[model samples]
Target: MKKYNRIKLWEGLHSSYWFVPLLITGAAIALAFFMLTLDSTGKSGLMEKSGLKIYTGGADSALTLLSTIASSMITVAGTVFSVTLVALTLASQQFGPRVLRNFMQDIRFKFVLGTFIATFIYCLLVLRSVHTDAEQPFVPKISITVAILLAIASILVLIYFIHHASTSIHAWHIIREISDELESNIDYVFSENPGNSHPEHKRQLVEEITTGFEQQAYPILATGSGYIRAIDYDRLMNIAKSKDLLLHLKHRPGKFIVRGSKLVRVFPFERGNGKLTKEINYAFILGRERTAFQDVEFSIKQLVEIAIRAISPAVNDPFTAIRCIDQLSVALCHLTQREFPSPYWYDDNDQLRLIADQVTFAALVDDAFHQIRQYGRQEVAVTIRLLETIATIAEYTRNKNNYVALLRHANMIRRGSENLFEKLDREDVEAQYQVVLQRLAKI
Candidate 1:
C-alpha cells in the first residue's frame, strides 16, 4: 500500500476537481465492460433469470438507443462545461479571482461533469457489445438498462446543476460559503487546548533562537520563488533531532518567498553538514498559490475580498458589506476563545530545534476588516457595522491585548468616519463608536 501524508494528500485532492472523478469515470467504464462480459459468459444465472423487461429490444435497437444516448450525453456534457465557464467568468468578474478556487473546488460541479462523462463512457462501452453476429446476436440487457437509467439520472442532475449554479453566484451565498470555510479552518487550527495562553514563553523562545542564530547559525536561502504552501514539521523536527541543530524558519505558510531569500537559519551552522540544507528545503513546500492548509489568513482574506468588492463604487452594496462584517466578527470571536499554537517546536528530548512564524489575533483582525473599512468609508452603515463588529469581538474576548487591538481598530473606524459622513450619519456612527468604547470599558 502506498502511504501519503494525510494533510498533503487531502490538500492535493482539494486543490483539484478532476482526479477522483476521472478515477470514478474510468471505474464505471470498466464495470460496465465487466458486467457485459459476465452476461456474455452465461455464468450469472440470476441475471439471466431476472424478469426485468427493460431492454426487450434486439441488438440493433439497443445499438441505436445507446448511441443516441451517448451522443446526447456528450452534448449535455458540452453544455455543462459551457455553463461552468460562464459562471466562473462571472464569479471572477464580480468577486475577486481568488474565489475561482471555490468554484473549482466545488464537488457538485465536478460530480455533475463526471456523471455525464461516466454515463457516456458506460454507454459507449456497453454499445460495443451489442452485435448481430453469425452464431448469436448479443445484447447486454442489464447494461443497456443501466445506461438508460443513467441517462435519466443525468437529466435530473442537469436540472439540479442549473439551479445550483444560479444560486451559488449570489453574493449572500458566496459570502456564507466563505464564512463557513473560514469558521471550519479556525476550528481546525485553533480548537486544541484553549487554556494555553502563554505568549511570554513563545517570546522567550523566539529571543533565544534569534540570539543563538546571530552567534553561530548559517542562513539557508530559498532556491525558488513562490508562496509557502505547507511545512512538514514532523520531518523537520526529526532532522533537527538527528542533526542536533536548531532551525529557525524565516517564512510561514502563505508567505511569498523569492529566490535567494533567507528560508531558514540553522544554529551551530557546521552541524547541518551541507546535506541537511537540501532536506530542510524539502520540508518546505512552495507553490504558485497559497492554500488554507496551515494558512488561516488566506481564508480570512476570501471574506475580505468579497466585502471589498461589495463596497466598491461599481457595486455600492453596503448590506453585503455589513453581512461580511458580521461573519468576520463571529470568526474573530471564535478565534479569541481558542489558543494559538506556539511557534516554537521541540524534539523528543525537549530541545528547541525549530522557530516558526505564527498568525496573531491582531493580524487576523486587521486582515479581516482593514480592506472593507477602507473601501466602505463613504458608507455610514458599513462604518457603524465595523464598530459594532469590533465591539462584539471585544465583548467575547478576555485578553487585554485583544481588547486593545479592537479598540485600535475602533479608533481607526471612528477617525475614518469623521469626514466621510454627514452630520446625522456621523452621529449614528459616533453612537456605535461610543458603544464600542463602552464595551471596552466593561472589558
Candidate 2:
C-alpha cells in the first residue's frame, strides 16, 4: 500500500463517505442488468424453473409493473450518485476544506461499509424477479438479511468517529491562546511605547549604578504589536543583556501577559553589559500598537493589567508616579493620533472591543484622567491655570482637567459632531498653547 498507496492519499481527494449512496446504487444497477441479460430479450422466464408462485389474486407483478431489475437498479444508482455529488460539493464549496477535512476524517470507513451493505440489500430485491409467479416468499432471502446487518454496523461506527474528532479539536484551542498572549506582551512593550514611555512625557533613561532596582518589576501587556521576531523572543533577551540589566532573568517563553502585568521579579545585578545605571532604568510597563492583536479578548485583558500596574507607582511613590503617569499619557496620545483622530487620547475601544468584558480600557483611560487631575487640584492657581491652557492645545492634556469633556461635548457644536478642535478658534488655541509653552519652559 505504501508504494502507491491509495488509502494514504484518498483523504487528499474528496471525502469517500460522500460517495456512499452512489456506490450502493451502482451495485444495484449491476445486479439488475446481469439478471435481465440472463433472462433474455425481455421475453423468456428463467423464473419457471425456479418454482416461485404468485399469491396475490390479480396482484400486479413487480417485474412487469415496476421493471424491478431496471427501475430499482437505476433508482438506487441515481440516488447514490446524486447524494455523493451534493454532500461532497457542499463540503468543499460552502464549508471549505478545513471543516470538511475534520468531518471526513471521522466517518470515512463506516461509510464504505454502509455502501457495501446497502448494495447487498438491493441485490436481494433482484432475487424476487429471478424466480416466476413470485408471491411474498415464506423465507427472507439470505442476501437481504446479511446486507441489513452490515448497514447497521457501518452507521454505528460512523457515530463513534464523529464523537472522537470533535473532542480533539476543543483541546487544541487552549494552548494556542497561551502562546498568542506572550507574543502580544513583547509587541506592546518594545513597539507601542518605544521612543517614549508614555503619552505626556518624552522618555528619559534613568541610568545609575546603585542597588536602586532592588525590588523593581513591571507588567508587559499584550495590546501592542505582537512579537516581531517570528523566529523567537531572542531579540528581547539580547536587549536586556545590552542594557546590562540582564541579571537574574525569570520567565518561561510563550506565556500570555496582560497590560501592566508583572514578569519575573528581579533587582539590578552587577551592571556591566553597556548599561548605565542612571541612564537606562527599567521600562517594564509596555503596550503594543493597535493592529498587532488578532484575538481581541486576549489583548484587552492584557491592556487592563498594564493600566492597573501603571497606577501602582502613584500610591507607592508619588514622585515616580508623576513621572510614570506623565510619560504614559504622552505615549498613549501619540499612539492614538498616529492612526485616526480620537476624542479621548487613549481609546482602546475599536481594537480591544472583543475583550471588553475582561478589561475595560476605556475605564482605565478615564481613571488615569481622574488621577492626573488631582495634581492640579491643589490651591496653586498657577498650576491650575497652566493645566487648563495645556488642555486646550493638547486635548490629551485635558483628560485630567475635565477639559476634554468640554471639547468632547456633542451638544456644544452646531454640526452635531464633537470635534471641538475642528471648530475652535485657531488663534485662541494658539494663544493658549503659547502660554503653556512659556510655563513649561519656566518649569
Candidate 3:
C-alpha cells in the first residue's frame, strides 16, 4: 500500500468509536485466559507467598465478586455510550457536523469507552471460571484480583471522561482545537521554500512546457462522483514517468467531481490506454466528504463555519466569532512565513512529468475569511477584528502577493463597515484599517 493510503486506513480506524474497544476487548479476553492458566497451574498462590494476599476467597465468594463487577461495568459502559452520543449531538448542533470528527477522533473518549467494555468482558470471563458445585472446585483468584484492579481503574477513567466530555463542548475549546489543527496542517503541507528564486520564472517555465499539450492531450474522465479526498502524487508521477507521459491534473484535493468529469489530461494521446486509465483512477481516493488529511481548506472551512454560525442572527455571539478570528489570524500569520510547493513535478532527468493543480495563498485567505466578512459585515466588532486579523497577517508576510490579498480584504471590510457602523464604531474600524495599511507598507 502507498504511504498515504496506509495513513488514511489508520486514520479511519483511529477516528472510529469501535476500533479501540475492539482491541481492548481482545486484550481482555487474552488476559482472562492467561490468568486462568496461572490459577489452574497453582501459580496464583505465588502472589500469596509474596504477601500480596489479594482476592483469596472461595469459589462462591469469587463468583459473587466477579458477578458484581461484571454487572456494574456493563451498566457503566452503557452510561458512557449514552453520554458520548449526547456529546456528539451537542457538538454537531453547535459547532457544525464536520466538527464532530474531532470528538469522534478524541482518544480520551475512545479510551474510556474501551476501558469500560473491556472491564465488563474481563469480569464475565473470570466469572465463568468460578464453580462451587463442581467435583473439583476452582476459582481463578488471580483473574478475580485483576478484575478488581480493572474496576478501580475504570472508576478513574469514568471521572476523567466526565471532565473531558464537559470541557470539549465549550466554544472556545473547539475553536482552539481547530486552530491548532490548522497550524499543524500548514506546517505539514508547506514545509519547503520555493526551489526557484522567483516564482514567476517557474510559472513561465511551466507554461513553456505545457504550451501546446492542451490541444493534443487525452482527457481522463472520472468514473465516479465524489470529493477528491487525497491524490497519490508519487503513484501518479511514477505512472507518468514509466509510460513516458506528461499528466496534467485538472483538480486538486477537496474538489467535487461528477461522473464523466475531466480528471486529468495526458500528453501524447497515442500512448493512452484503458489500463493506464484504471491505474490513474486508482491513484485518486474519493470520498463522500472532505478530510483534513491533504485538504487544508477543510480545517479552514470548519473554523469559518463556527464563526459564521456564532455571528448569525439566532446566535448573535460576537465573542465566539472574535475567538475564531483570533485563531485564524494565528494560522494565517504562520502561513505567511511558509512557502507553498510548486505545482510542477519533474523526473530525475529534470523533464517535467506531472502538472498538478495547486493551492494558492490568496485562495486560502479567501477561504479563511470571506464568509465571515460577508456574514459579519453589520457587526462592528467582527468587522474591526477582520481588519485587525489582516494587519496581524501583514506583519509576518514579505510576499507582495500576500500583501495584495491582505489589503484587498482590509479594504472590503472598510467599505462594508462604512455603510453599517455608526460614527464612533466607524472610527474604531477606520483606525484598524489604517493599522493594516501601515503594517502591509513595511518591508
Per lDDT, the best of the predicted structures is 3
lDDT of 3: 0.86
TM-score of each model, paired residue for residue: 0.92, 0.22, 0.95
**Superposed Cα RMSD, model 2:** 21.6
Query: Over all chains combined, what TM-score does candidate 1 have?
Result: 0.92
What would the per-residue lDDT of candidate 1 be over residues 1-443, giving only the tens digit for each residue?
Answer: 01224666666787687875697699887879787976777634565567545566787888899999999998999999899999999999998899998888888998998899998999988987788885878888778878889999999999999999899899888888888888888886676421123345566755765774656888888878898877777777778888788788888889999988889888887775457778888888778888786678998898888888888989888888888888888899999897777777766555677777778899999998789888888888888888988888888898888888899899999999989637999899998999999989987
Candidate 2 Cα errors over 4 Å, as ranges? 1-77, 97-100, 103-117, 120-129, 133-443
Task: State each model's CA lDDT, in order.
Answer: 0.82, 0.35, 0.86
Tell me model 1's lDDT, rounded to 2 decimals: 0.82
For model 3, give the 10-residue run with minimal summed lDDT: 192-201
The collision pairs in model 1 are none
Candidate 1 stretches greater than 4 Å from native:
1-6, 43-50, 133-135, 191-209, 346-350
State which candidate, 1 or 3, has the greater TM-score.
3
Best first by lDDT, ranked: 3, 1, 2
Candidate 3 segments exceeding 4 Å error = 192-205
